[model samples]
Target: MSERVLMKGNEALAEAAISAGCKCFFGYPITPQTEISAYLSKRLPKVGGVFLQAESEIAAINMVYGCAGTGTRCMTSSSSPGISLKSEGLSYIAGADLPCVVINVQRGGPGLGGIQPSQADYWQATRALGHGDFHVIVLAPSTVQEMADLVTRAFDLADEYRMPVMLLADGLLGQMMEPVVFKKREENGKSFDKSWAANGHGGKRKHNIINSLYLEATELEEKIHERFKRYDEIKAKHTMAESYMTDDADVIIAAYGSTARLARTAAEKARSLGIKAGVFRPITLYPFPVNELREATKTAKRVLVCEMSMGQMVDDVRLALECKIPVDFFGRTGGIIPKPEEILEKLKGV
Candidate 1:
């Protein structure tokens, strides 16, 4: 039977990762995301798992790389500044086609930004996170339940594609407590195939190498092309989003993460005032529910892109609709969160 529990988003994410059979965690403590590390530190040992508080975000991600290289399910988490430090390791893991999970409880950014929610890292995540031609599957969870469910899915997708996965949440989601129905544990009896693991093989198979380098430029290009093909398949299969009151609305609000949650409340208030305002929340930030946005724009004449950042995701909304409709932006930054009432006022102006 499924259990109902009240959990903070970060805690839920840790529990979900544990439920998915993740045996290793390596992370540095950062505000808005420290709870995840704390949860794992206490619970992982009891479950015969490992949780290491590395010296730095860079070191933590590298530890994840090492564990994942052994074909063990592993994870790491941090906020914006810390995630920036982890970019190098992330690129390395992507290059090696290693399966691991990285959670970014997003805070304000640029450099040493505040510890409040923000969706400013859209470019950093969707574009190459580090100096490389690689991509990580990025999942944006707006609610506490999704924070849990998506972390589990992130592991499955990471292992399935042999690529890094990121659970992109924000401070509001991290701190908020909500009711969630935890998935019932299932014993599939099928274990992970570790034939490729570097576990001191005793001549069971040929020696394996896990390097990102290809001496031949052509061979490296081919490998990158193949990886992009896999990404294309992932994009097709993993575009997740939610549309509320959008079917016949005159105005649509495009947002994600905490901004989306606030937008929902604003949209409800707008509806009470007889205004046709709706919300479209993108659950997967990387693949981005472009098609859904396109469909919503087909009927709506205007859209308001709200975010904690200045205008990162607004760009995606514009690109999705190709400027077919008028797109306006509302945002706050540097640890300030937008209020739902203010959003409702903005809709009234529209």
Candidate 2:
């Protein structure tokens, strides 16, 4: 039997990293996510792991780049502003194809907007997190248990693909506490190949060169094409989503992360009122679950997307449906979380 424990989302994520064999963590403190670093600061040393408090977010992510080059299981965590500062390092890690996990326990943003829960970073996360043609495996976890589970998946997927994976969460999930039956490491199905890791094996092995720069245009173009091939395979095989009461519904709510919880409640309320309603939650933001969403909502008359940001994710929903069915968006920004009553009211209008 798995061990069940009550923990806050941020603290559970810290412990999950330890369980996933992450031995090095480099990050700077930021609001709504400080608990992750603080918990790891105390726990990592006890597990013979390294915990570093860098001078800045920029310095911290660069340290992650250095550590990951050495084939170490390393990670970092921060909020929106700190994540913005780490983008350069993130791009470098992606270009070099180094394996690492970066957690974003998000807060309201545009520029230091507020320390409250928000999903305003969806565009930055899914579209242009870095200044290059690159994509990270973005996972959205709604509850405390999912917060822990996805951390393990993030490390596994990062190592398997040799790229950075992001856990895109918000302050609400990070702050709330719940019971999680922490699964054993054996539950992870992904296989990791470390043959190319730069683990100081001196003269017995060939040197592993980790570099993102290509002086030759032809060489850079060739590498980019190869990366896109891998991305295509991932998109075909790794799409994940969850659907609730979507069958025979007239209207559907498309949501993810913390906002999905209210959507679920609103759907239930809608059902009680004799209106056919359901929910579709995307677990993976990048390499999104396009086919599943299209299948689940194809028969529906309309789709309503609710989010903490001003219609960021709604764009993806519209694209997935190809604008065939009517899509409407209702959202609240700057740290405001919409109540289920409000979402239900909006659904009635939809």
TM-score of each: 0.96, 0.98
- Please, what is the whole-model Cα lDDT of each candidate in the order they appear? 0.89, 0.92
Residue 173, model 1, lDDT = 94
Error of 2 at 197 (Å): 1.9
Residue range 198-315, candidate 1, lDDT tens digits: 7667887887677788899999999999999998998888888899899988899998887898999999999999998889999888888888778765678899999888888888
Q: After superposing candidate 1, which stretches have Cα over 4 Å from the reference?
A: 188-194
Q: Model 2: per-residue lDDT, tens digit, 161-222? A: 88899999999999999998778777545567887878787799878888999999999999
- What C-alpha RMSD separates each model from the true structure? 1.5, 1.3
Q: Please, what's the RMSD in Å of model 1?
A: 1.5
* Candidate no. 1 TM-score: 0.96
Residue 91, candidate 1: how far off, in angstroms? 0.5
True-structure Cα RMSD, model 2: 1.3
